[model samples]
Target chain A: MHRVRLGIVGCGIAARELHFPALVQLTDKFEITAVTSRRRERAEDFASMVKDALGYEPAVFDSYEELLESGSVDAVDLTLPIELNVPFIFKAVEKGVHVICEKPISTDIENGKKVVELSTNTDKVIYIAENYRHDFRFNKIRAFIDENTIGRPIFVAWHLWIGMDKSNKYVQTEWRQRPKHIGGFLSDGGVHHIAALRVIFGDIAWVSGVTKRVSDYLGDDDTLSTVFEFNSGVVGNYTVSYAVSGKQYFEIVGTDGRIYLDEERITVRGQREETINIPNQNTFKNEFEDFYRVVKHGEPNILGHPVDALKDLSFFEAAIKSKDTRIEIEDLLRSTTPD
Target chain B: MHRVRLGIVGCGIAARELHFPALVQLTDKFEITAVTSRRRERAEDFASMVKDALGYEPAVFDSYEELLESGSVDAVDLTLPIELNVPFIFKAVEKGVHVICEKPISTDIENGKKVVELSTNTDKVIYIAENYRHDFRFNKIRAFIDENTIGRPIFVAWHLWIGMDKSNKYVQTEWRQRPKHIGGFLSDGGVHHIAALRVIFGDIAWVSGVTKRVSDYLGDDDTLSTVFEFNSGVVGNYTVSYAVSGKQYFEIVGTDGRIYLDEERITVRGQREETINIPNQNTFKNEFEDFYRVVKHGEPNILGHPVDALKDLSFFEAAIKSKDTRIEIEDLLRSTTPD
Candidate 1:
């Protein structure tokens, strides 16, 4: 199969840690044809790393539009912050390039909806890189639920807590803490949990939440507990805390059993309980490989299509409204917010 | 040690499934002196079960007050519905009997607080049966957190979902589904998660939530999700759903590690991730043994203390207020409703 030429639109941590490293490993699947960052020096630094490691150097563009119009790349990966990437996605779709964007496609619901509509009109595939769904351990649990190994799910509890080092250079520059840019933790981190739950359980019919900033560093709240009522009548409780001092874990409970996932293990129980060891394979590499396959073969990856991404985005928008108005979000389409 | 004569109020599921069986196992620590139920048939049936199994015929009462005044019992296990249990607890306290009541000590905050105050005034011990905290898996995780195996907790995602059978005769009779009597799902099922989180984290600073009813047969809502901010700046998200079709699971994420627990197993992850084989021991048996040890030998069992029970009840009250007002609850004392 011919390699899909890729242009990355952000040079931040996600770009450095995930995209760049992943592109290097899947050399036969993808080529980094062009790169852009707000700071030319940072982009150059990233380009140097790619050149030194992969023995290939891509052209650099200070402007995202310039990179898109160059016509050298077949696809664009929007790794930029939500505020900047929302517009970039529309432009990429307009240019007829297949796009893969990071989560919270846009901080605002209207803009997120627009991105979904644009993708639908252009026939360009828009994939939300929700890595949690792609993680092998979670995928296994999802399969288990489908197989009814645990029986019917009555309730589900998910915990995703990661302590962020504020002093880390990547976290310092990220737009996550800014409510205007990323819609706080509920929009930033909370979206991942919301999307994952929707993927595992089904559609969320209603949601309500409380959001708060426990840390002094972030202007917006970093902590939130959101409840989801599924269309199947399953009840779910999720606690998302940024202030917790620990690693990440996810668990799902069913009538006959329960399943749990972390970085290196999946434990499940019901009529009988068992724990499976999950080898700590680099999840980012696996995710990128799937994205490349989808781009190359028109294969449907587990992250779902652009419309599915939009549905997840819609839930994020509703969660914010639920937090602000203290009302249960019944209808995503009817749910409105300030621009 | 002389055997402590026990009187059980409410021959409900908890009494049958948990207390009665456990009492049988700890024959050396306890003797079933009497049993009470609103219905004469149930009281007689329970008395017969005890008599047939133990070969000791205990008295039966149609009312709890009669059981308390029988003078044949030293302690009362108040397993009545939350609404009925609160008044029964006060009556037991007035009779100078030690009390072990089931969770959510009261549906109303004011009543729960009064129970706390009344216990403080009397010499009688009031142990609330919060078995989740006593469960060995949670205790192991809590010890690891205390030891900093996971580092400082910056974020936490906790979820507990359990599927229930609507046709189950025991569940059908449960008062937990009625909002007027038990404060619904959030009050009944949710308090377990709330109380557990409070014990592991700290006092809840604020809470916001949404509640909904999925089942037509129940008067109370079947689904709920609530966000809590701890006074220590730790933010948490809690979700509970009665409509889910699966098993029960709980997970905790910390700075350096993560812990996952279900009925069958426990897994912890950090720099090194390990899944431990947790034996499927009946937790209620452990709870009863601990209570017996404390009552007979003056041994310190964490859940055997009255103050801890009161604290769990206080958190239950706070969660209900947070659910009702759709606001962050800062002062649990002020938000409590009178009994």
Candidate 2:
């Protein structure tokens, strides 16, 4: 079996901290062949780091197009800012290269649908790197729900409250400070939460939400309180705030029992109580492995499909727009999907 | 201080288990002089218990009307079922007796408003015993919010998930099994949550909610997920479930800090973290003391006001009824208030 040659796009903190560490562990399935960034020095630094980890020096391209057209790589790993995702995804897929782009597919529904439409016109996999979908704890939770371990999930309450101060690396980014997207961090970090919910409860059917700007630095809306009704007959309250720090937990309550998830623990309360300490998982690595398998082994695309990321974008956009009325997720998609 | 002569109505579990024990502690402030129940034996048993505690035997009346008219009490403590609350309240107030009734004031908005109207026509205090208002933990929370301990309040998430099984005394009652009111236990027990929120914030400006029947035994709708917008510019998600047992916690997130409340503790995270061990106070006793002061000492009514309880009922009803649309709490109140 031959390894899939990969190029890294956008050599910012996510590329350096998250993706590079993950790529180091997948030397057998994936190899870093080329890299590109707006800042050529950062791309050079990334290439050097890749050589340090993989014992090879890859070409550093001046632009994403150069990386896509040079044929030095079979696929490109996109870690670009949110707004740049669509054009790069389209370029990679149209250029006949498998691509795993960072979430979301796009910041809004229209561009997300456009990317989805473009993916179907080709055989090259347009995988999305929504790492939350690959996180093992949610898989454990999904298995619990699938096995009736909690006696049918009736309700869910998920809260993500963290203070994104100046010291935080993500908070220091220019795009995040003045987000060009609809809901700022709500679309950026919030999509991961949506992806996790989709993994555990299926697609969201409808949503009603209220957004607040508790912190001026977090952009348009730093806080969102939303009620989502899933197609699987489960309703949940999901609130995400980048404004102030508080408890971060996701709880699912069922007829006979309840399941709770925090950052590092899973507590299941049924006839007997069980608390599982969730081990640290490199989610980016897991997603990359899935992307590699889908591209190389012709494995089925479940976790990395662009459509799943599109749905996540749709839910977040609908939540931002749903102030006083409930927005049906399917209707939002139908309206936004290009003919 | 002269002990206010109090008549006990409806000798059910709440009256026997809750009010009786409280009355024992308040012998100097309130004297149980007359008792009446649908069951003559329960009323006689209550009188004997009062005699054993207060060192005097009180008259046992065959009917609430007889007890009111016999001049055996200056104020009546009504511990009847939900449907009986409005009528008994009207009878006692019209008979010129100050009454402390169990929440809610009524099952529906129309009846609740009628009781509110009847209270305005006389000087006899119509106190609604919503013990959550008297619960000191909420007062501590209210103080924290008022002191800006958490800065300007941004959001709140309150979850109440408890199983009402056969062994639970309240679940064994015939009325609870076959509830005639709207939302059943939602209004029966959910009003306390609304009361706690009102105490912390202010009046709920509007509400959007979805209710589910997770347990067949808990009544029409055993689960509720609601987004409440307070008039004071705070928005919150308050979900209550009587179908399953999970964590019962109320969290308030503000611009500067956050306050967390569980069943046994209050955790405040701000410039300095504070964990308050919430000592148990007999909330019933606290409310009785307030009732005694209001009836005998001409003290102001705040905690036990009937209007406050009516608001609790209205909020719960609106949440239950607001399925596809948002319900403005003030509009609901205005529509129900009789001219």
lDDT, candidate 2, B119-163, per-residue tens:
778899999998999889888989887887878888899988876
lDDT of 1 by residue, B69-114 (tens): 7898888888877787677888888898988888766765455657
Model 1 CA deviation exceeding 4 Å by range: A46-50, A53-56, A174-179, A270-275, A280-304, A325-339, B1-180, B183-339
Interface RMSD of each: 15.6, 16.8
Report, to 2 decimal places, the DockQ of model 1: 0.14
Residues A1-339 of candidate 2 have per-residue lDDT tens digits of 499999999998888999989988988888889999999999999888887888999899999888888998899989988999988888888788888888878867777777777777889899989999988888889988788888888888998887787578898898888787768888888889889988899887767678888777766778888776887779889988887776686889887688899877999887557899999889999989888889988998889888788788777766655564533222222233222
Q: Report the error of model 1 at residue A307, Å.
A: 2.8
